[model samples]
Target: INGARLIMVATPANAHGDIAEQLAPFLKDDQIIMLNPGRTLGTHYFYNLLEKNGLKANVIVAEADTLIYTCRLVKNGLCRVFSLKKELHVAAHNPDDTQMVCELLSEFYDVIVPAESVLETGLSNLGVIFHPVPVILNIARIEEQSTFSHYKQGISPTVATFLEKIDNERIAIANALGVKVDTAVKWLNRIYRTEGDTLYEALQNNVAYTEVLAPTTIHTRYIYEDIQTGLVPLSILSKELGIENSAMDCVIRLASMLYNYDFYLNGRNEGIIDFQKIINSRKVAISR
Candidate 1:
């Protein structure tokens, strides 16, 4: 890691903090640390962690809105890649470093593209709209150990409609914070090149989702990881910006009940992230 110029963190969102603490001691100045699919506000959380862990290196921390590949583990030591995204949006913690980070990353992946800022990448997290709700809706089948495609079978027309409502609330929060982010429907088309008038249609049209299977148990990352790292921060931001977030709130509350855990208390909030700093940074980036 010390010898590497570019360090990519591809772990689940929940593990980011631990990874940050472990890497802080060894991180070198001018090195780049990128979170693959930062979920939401991931780089912010990680950067803060690094600082708290006594990191003195002037490293550039960046995050991607999504992973470059739609892949899954086939078995131990084996993985299957369904497809690679034609384009991927990445942004640095400091907006000024975004282009340099993208340019450096492009040597490894030509598909990399610079995003407006970390706010855009955070708000553009599609997994916040896609992952958790379906699992909650399909709890019965999942508990019964019934096999089904996560995107295709789990997300019915009705579930998809509800998911869109969640997406609408997310976009509303982004708008209130002065960040321009793609709606889930638009993001699907851009990433997968799947055409549809609605998010449900676009998801169904995405061939990459065909082989993705739903978790058979409740203790999956769909709920724990997405709710903790993705939806929780969105809920916090919506409150800070005075945006109505009943849809997000409902999901959070339901997830709490299902898991018998208070996600809000353990997840990112005002205490973990400075909401005003995030808002101010986005405003400054917009002015530039």
Candidate 2:
């Protein structure tokens, strides 16, 4: 790993803290560690883990809202790339450093647009918005090993309506943090270059996601990882920012009940969130 200036962390979101723990000692100052599509607040977990390890490295950490590609594995060491995103939203732990990281990343991806900060990137997470609800709504199919499309068949009109309220809560939290985030449908349009009047229609029209199917089992990362890591953090920040996220809360509670686990207490922990910074963010936002 010598002479490596950048490390791309593409592991499952739940494993980020553990991976950070192991990679902490080897990271050099000025090196950059990027969480390729940190579900929600992944940079915080990475930055805090490194800091707590006393690495004192001047490394830059960044994250994206979603993966740059719609991809799936064909087999061991082989993968299928379905569609390359037209746009990808990104940000760093330190927002000021985002542009530099974006410049470096543009060489690989089609586009890397700077987000306001890691906070914005985290809140803008599309997976967190898309993954859990559909799985819960279709738990029977997921559990029974019934075959269906994740976006096409899974996200029904009812599920789409439910997700609309959840997405609204997310937008409210973003507003509370003084960050602007597009709603899920608008985000879909932005990234996929697809046009639709509604989210379900847009998702149905997006051929890139059409090939993706539902999980064979209920015990999948869509609920296990997304709720624990993604919704948990969003729930925390929403409560902290005083946004009433009942839909988000209900999802978390149901996931915890179904899985018999407390995601909030068990979710990624390296003491990363630094409540003072959040308070400062509130102050700055209010001032503006």
Candidate 3:
């Protein structure tokens, strides 16, 4: 109903802010807009849109500390939750609304923590941005194989270091943007319900992240799932936020170069015959 007090938007990371922008005009002054999984720019985008559109509605961009902790079933336009959170942490444009929003969410969720700000909840995200790079770069060898199991694969020590690097960069970026980030690594372990202090330690210590991987070397879904969708969103977010970063740019550039090689090889085998053109075009742009 247009009279709804709370509006929740769940879309891809890149699309959430825009969706909120379009919905701003329809929202009542007291209505709360929540973006599930605000990844990075979710709050900034929504705030910018409200200012740009001259909307006076109270907007809150809330992020799930863990990815929607429920087994949900959708049928006949109804969502059934087998398990739901007891509490949720919410960050809003106005810190004063935290309690009110928490009270509203308490109807569906068991608990709601009033985070000092939305940035706190946003930075505490355990999934998308932080877990992508290690899954991709570390599994490059397996991605060339015929088949592989993604979820079951174990993380190598070297790859663990990479993940830490990415996590550090993310935290630094968040701080630079005036967003106080909680311990991202520690939060990841907490969400996973593991004993390790960080994802790296969890991978090494926890029996789950170290499950027996598939024997076959075929491509795993991790690359596309985490790298393409997850990491790409983070890179884009960092750029938009004007966060100082060279490590992420390097990783992205390396991935692009590797993808170019794949494209060239596939084209050669398929008689696509335009490899030189691709190189020339990119070179011209670089020269520009």
**Steric overlap count per candidate:** 0, 0, 7
Put the candidates in TM-score order, highest first: 1, 2, 3
Of the two candidates 2 and 3, the one with more favorable TM-score, higher being better, is 2
The 0-to-1 C-alpha lDDT of every candidate, in the order given, reads 0.88, 0.81, 0.54
Segments in model 3 whose C-alpha atoms lie over 4 Å from true places: 50-66, 70-87, 128-130, 138-154, 173-184, 196-198, 207-244, 255-288
For model 2, how does the per-residue alpha-carbon lDDT over 194-226 read when each residue is reduced to its tens digit?
789788888989987887898888888888778
Which regions of candidate 1 deviate over 4 angstroms?
A: 284-288
lDDT of 3 by residue, 1-288 (tens): 288777776554545535755776766766677766555434655666666666766555455444355544367667666555555667664567777777787787666677766556655654544444544554555555534333334445566666676677678655654566655556546645656665566655555444434433323333333343344445544555566556655666665575552321211111312223323443464467
Best by lDDT: 1
Return the lDDT, model 3, position 288.
75
Candidate 1 lDDT by residue in tens digits, 1-288: 968999999877888888999999999989999999788898889989999898999999999988888788889999898778788899998888999999998888989989987778888888888899999999999999999999999999999999999999899988887788888889778767899988789989999789888987978988888998989999888888888889899999988988899988878777778988888766776688
Clashes of 1: 0
Whole-model lDDT, candidate 3?
0.54
